[model samples]
Target: MSAAILFDGPKDAPFTLVLAHGAGAPMDSPFMAAVAQGLGARGRRVARFEFPYMVERRASGRKKPPDRQPVLLECWRAIVAELGGGSGLVIGGKSMGGRMASLVADECGVRGLVCLGYPFHPPGKPEKLRTAHLETLRTPALIVQGERDSFGGRADVEGYALSPAIRFTWMTDGDHGFRPRKASGLTEADNLAAAIEAVDAFLAACGG
Candidate 1:
């Protein structure tokens, strides 16, 4: 993990956000770009980095799968170290990236955490939950999920005994990436704006 590729906001901004990409996308994927830019516009410095596998994929132009969980965890740790040991930083990302960050947040002692479109389980495999650690997680965090996400919808997540420190904001009629159905009368931009606002408020509440 070299120094992260940054999409800087204001130089003297009060907050720093460190983000990693999901399993299937690069750090600069459209989804990542939107969140980074949206948040950056609101006055926070944003840093985006890739895991080992994604970096390789970028160089080779090959569609490689995600790294093993341990490697991803180590990658998050490295990013945390690079970003000044996390004291005044918020750590999170999209889906798998966000999940990996959650695995290290308590250990890193980050100021906050945010997850966009968290995948609670593999598609159509509801029983294979990836939420055990989230149950007892102590790091203040927000999971902004789409209402109809194939991975984890509102109904599915409502049954879990998640940590008290965790909060959720459901994007109406949204799929995994938060694109709502046309009939729902809400555009993707609407959801994106709502999600950004939710994250902004979450960061503010963290007082970082």
Candidate 2:
């Protein structure tokens, strides 16, 4: 019942990190690739998978909207069950992928959750916040988000009622994709390294 997976790093690693792709991209997107490689090189097993719609899109070579929320959550449920009920595991991904993981992390009984570029709401619509569950989320979560992400910037998140168990690593001046403007004196690569480092530290803290 598991989605096909693209895996990286040692199979025998202490923990496995499962990542899903964003709404508009595949599992091998440059951003996902970089983070998976970076984290894998640091000695964690990483796996990436596509939702059914994305899989079909690949086969048909056509653009399609994301699956409905129920379908998306079911995909995560299957993925979690495939990965040994999420024990000693971390689940997350870029944007929508990450958001879906957050929705299932506590339910899966995972050791931890990691969300890269979590969307607080649809872009240009700040009134529709997607953070109600986050306020009470457990599962020792870490969110690595762009400081100025169009979806949910640092300023916007500061006023939200997120859980105390969740910590954040903000990529300074980075956009939704974690790319910084040249004037910020920080490259996209730099922010990626920071994000990877934060995840590594978090995993170590979790005894992985």
Candidate 3:
């Protein structure tokens, strides 16, 4: 079964991009909303949904940690199945959400994967890498990461043996949330816009 989805853009759009929230936020977070709305405005259908834990938190008015990896991956699978088996779908999300999507992108046979601020590892714990599967991922992927993301800064991530199928678009001096440093003379909105543009181009390349 698929989680309830909040959708944007025309139903007849060529491809449906399904996005999940990060570990802490809901699907309607400011960041999620901006990206969804931005893509919607560009003529791509966008769908946003929450994981089971986040859904429960929404109903109970309480904070909750993210679900375990198995549960999160199951949710991605169900979402893809419910959306008609992912032939024309692009699956992705913010941070942990994106990571979960990446884990299942190939399994689901999605047309493409777009990871916004992918967590290469926990913040300040770079030794615990979470990219073994990524080394051989077959599905085309775009990882929009911050140049200085604490989870996996460019300097750190550049050395990883990720698959050639995976491409990256880096945000200037940005952190996990893609918010650049003020002194860097770049704004969060600027990075976000760039990210959106990259995703748009990626979708086009995927024949969306």
**What are the models' TM-scores?**
0.97, 0.97, 0.98
lDDT of 3 by residue, 107-204 (tens): 88999999999999988899999999999999999999999998999999999999999999999999999999899999999999998899999988
Tens digits of lDDT, candidate 1, 151-199: 9999999999999999999999999999999999999999999998998
Question: Against the true structure, candidate 2 has what lDDT?
Answer: 0.91
- Which residue runs of candidate 3 sit more than 4 Å off their true CA positions? none
Worst 10 residues of 2 by lDDT: 1-10
Q: Which candidate is the best by lDDT?
A: 3
Using TM-score, give the best candidate's number: 3
For the record, the alpha-carbon RMSD of candidate 1 to the native fold, in angstroms, is 1.1
State the lDDT of candidate 2 residue by residue for 1-208, as single tens digits: 5457888889998889999999999998899999999989999899999999999998899999999999999999998888787896899999999999999999998888889999998989999999999989988999999999999999999888889989999998999988999999999999999999998898887778
Query: What TM-score should be assigned to candidate 3?
Result: 0.98
Better of 1 and 2 by lDDT: 2
Q: Give the TM-score of candidate 2.
A: 0.97
